[model samples]
Target: MARDINTKKLKKNAFRYSKVRGETASRIRIPGGVINAKSMAKIAEVAETYGNGTIFVTNRQGVELPGIALEDMPAVNKAIQSIIDDSGVNQEERDKGYPASGTRNVVACPGSRLCPFGCYDTTEFARKMDKMIFPNNLHVKIAFTGCSNDCGKVRMDDFGIIGMTEPQYDPNRCVGCEQCIKYCNIRSVGALSLVNGKVVRDTDLCIGCGVCVAYCPTRAWTRSKEHYFRLVLLGRTGKKNPRLAEDFIKWADEQSIMDIVKNAYAYVEEYIDPNAYEGKEHIGYIVDRTGFDEFFKWIMKDVKLNDKAEVAHRIYWGGKHYDRSNNLK
Candidate 1:
């Protein structure tokens, strides 16, 4: 007898329906892509016991345990409670597994904690962001990269938070080695030039990637004390249209970003298509339906940007619109 399953409930509980009959995969949330060894051991234990001993890693820095029986979901949930507790994921009920899976796992790169080019602590910020927005049923994706290198591939997400550092130049320490100038041109935007034996940066052209600061051999260029970010918006990968994110704000503060993301939830609630599949839709699509001005109005509600922040008045995205025409240009 085929077991009747409520697919909706199965997905809501973070369990993926498997192609094999009576089998499902359990999705585990690992915010910031960091997990303690103990939690990992627990996950392994569950996989060996309930699943077919396969742990598949996801692009969003999460893991999926496949080949578990549908009837064993309860046991699996009870077993993974320790992992959930260890990961500090926000849950509505104890031992019930994840409350919702619409909001995908918050992805992040190993920032200043491990990487030399990292501008900020990517793991810490990713965990904080997850705490703020997880257990949500909205179809939203957010990713954080340590620096402009974008090791986390943030641009593909709905909200891409890239770390930035204002390069602080000390003229007294400069020796005119021009290493900063050399690397800036090679690895980043050519924004640095030599004038009167001193490197001068083109403020307008600079993207705050900190290539100069990293390549400066004479300690002339240093990173700013205050952490900054570049917030990119509306990047998505779908059959209709796939595109990279565009810059929404530069030199944005952390609090302002958080507030903006929170406000976006409200915006989605107001404008999201009620008939959307399972009452969920990507924010980019909603923004497409409503004007960018309206989205800006909602996301910027009561959000105070930093003095150095630069916001785009309007945004136009370029991507392959499969919906319009499938013919290759």
Candidate 2:
């Protein structure tokens, strides 16, 4: 098969962001950022054999091989076959090469796999999402954070999946040590208090951060049966209008999250203008051009949120659209 090496389609083969003429950077997708010692050795070997001597660690928890000659990409691809296979980043097209890269890499915090305060398995979910969404050119970004700490910096991505945990309190088992209350007051949203010598939790103020569950020494605070996520959307960093994402789905389920993301690509295809911006159009800009209601209608088409899922009733975007007027100073 002819390698999809066109500058426009270079992403399909993980070659993008040109450097000097005749050279481009090849991004290696490390799904869920779980590169083991063996994988590291493999990457080092590829870099030494087919690329520049050094590899750049991407913020998205992936690797980038810079200074690769365009002509050498074929040999480079062959050299890193084992490394790519181990990462399973090519799940969509398992024939040996990447299918596409517009979805970019799926990022996740060191979740329950390593972090003490992590609520869920971020790496597992990240890889799963990657398998489903990648190998296509959708120009989308997604991130997963194990807890409210948001170590993965989810706010900058188009889709942010935050782990949520409903804390259950048992008054009888409470020793009134006030540990949960103290932790909540100082580290969390201050959703806990003491009344009548018993600890009380204000459910309305709770952000499902799981801080109380971890701080309770008496085991009075526990995780609720529901395993849910808070889905935020439309975040972007661009020259025209830069802004953080807004909350879209609260207490969302895994299936609904997937549906909304899959639908979003379809929405983009209908409204996108290939030549509108200098390059690919960020989804945020697309939403801005089309009214929110219209954009919402497309993504939510036939999508049924979970019974417990809460959808935002209204969406508003606020950002400065840079123009000559703003730069006229």
Candidate 3:
């Protein structure tokens, strides 16, 4: 007869079953990844009663409680549900679950809602994005930041959103000060002290980082009258390769934002194989394998390009290159 297999012993060792070893785990989702005082207190109470009296804060703004008995899972879930419901907050959403190994994670920074340098309200935009544009089965992490300061770490996500401000020049007000030229690190601005007592700039060099606009004391250099946010796609920072996101769309408003996100998701759904799990679960990987131009064409098929003036303002950073000829215009 074959040797008796120690099935019971094997099962006990193979799976960390809470019933056999007496442990449990629970995960909670915080919408927009924000948790308030009442939610914290309720979570603490649940942990005290059914768990190990401790909680773990996840990178994606989730809360986890571990080391509880198997019997406590239902009670813990119920308690958390009640707490969330009583607080008049609905935390139950299908796409909010944590990914097993891929990159369908969403991260956001405190945009204009809280930060001073924020060009637009990142939080509000993120919430909108979470609602309509998230991928159904695509495994890609997305991140959003209100400004280029990148407090939200958008550079690390597969898809990212960053804020930008464009500079405008009032030729009449420019006093031929070379301050903007001196401050620009990108050399986007060139200053010439003409015999006519005026300074000029070469607009071609402007990359629009906004260094000179912010430093201008006279406020002669101004950002575009209509300030909007820009979205960057296909960025990744990891061991295999590290890279910064490139600007794909400029001067995107709420409607345009929705269009862009939806189109991106649609493209991913069509082109990417649902079963393939090669390496990174980010759009950047797809872009690398294929090409960004192809992806852009797919998503931006019907989208109309913003005017050159609008586009110019969206990419402008402050510098002293006002055209005196158009002072009145």
Candidate 4:
């Protein structure tokens, strides 16, 4: 008789159960969606050898080899071993499948390496975040967008990390061209305006998108060394309320970003429902059960933010409970 599939182990390797009994689909991790040609060949080989000779690219930018029989899992897993190493799927520990399954694939937009508008190295930073938080059972989605274009759809993810740049202006070099103002009005947070024939940036309205900084001529605008990040949180799709992720962190440094994300895992562990199905609960749902005030308390617990970093001044969700009371949940 074929051995029973170890649901726990398979999930750790990014496998999902199929409709057909005694079969599964293995999700191959490609952090930041960056994959080498050689690795792609190996994945195809695994599919042909142990699966249905096919692989599906997940919306999260990973690969899923379908039609794996429970009996063939061992062979499939062995094939995946080298890939896990080369891809750094779960390098948090050695000789282990994965610690948890909550943190999903780290999706990213094309970075400065490929796009001129890109601000940071999306794939590199995404890899760093992948190793930092993975294999956890809590349901979470983390994504990285290179710039304000948000080609990666950061706003729709559980944790959206958007690259930011603080533009420093040299008034002496100002040509009174009103170019920044024109650029800022569209495709931006509407923070720039002409003041006395020079561009004045409204700090409150600015989202740190670097639009003016990019379009500014004569080198009047320069990027800050701080390398800030804007973090949006909690947006999800589920049986109940589906809403866009809300912005929480603005102008955060790498350290602050890492710390807040690390702390968020702790928050999930603390408030996570015990009776959740499949040994998991969406963090968004947990936030619903508990109040946002309570949820953020845990998120912000014991974390020191940078002076530049701004926490959500007042987080307000207009949507009501499923009951339709229309109050913040």
Best by TM-score: 1
Tens-digit lDDT string for candidate 3 (1-329): 33343433322211123443557556555535555788789888877888789987877665667676655554665677654453233234322222122334356677657765566666666656665543244566667776666778776665677776667777678776767767664343443233364445455444444566676778877766655666666666554455666665656655665676678777776667555654225665565556756776776767665563233212111222233232554
On lDDT, the leading prediction is 1
Q: Write down the lDDT that model 4 would get.
A: 0.79
Please report, in order, the local distance difference test score of every candidate based on alpha carbons: 0.93, 0.81, 0.58, 0.79
* TM-score, prediction 2: 0.92
Question: What's the ranking of the predictions by lDDT, best on top?
Answer: 1, 2, 4, 3
What is the full ranking by TM-score, best candidate first?
A: 1, 2, 4, 3
Residue by residue across 10-90, what tens digits does model 1's lDDT show? 999999978898899999999999999999999999999999998999989999999999999999999999999999899
Q: Which of candidates 2 and 4 reaches a greater TM-score?
A: 2
Model 1 compared with the native: what TM-score? 0.98
Report the C-alpha displacement of residue 40, candidate 2, in angstroms.
1.4
In candidate 1, position 7 carries an lDDT of 92
Q: TM-score per candidate, in order?
A: 0.98, 0.92, 0.66, 0.90
What is the RMSD of candidate 4? Answer: 3.2
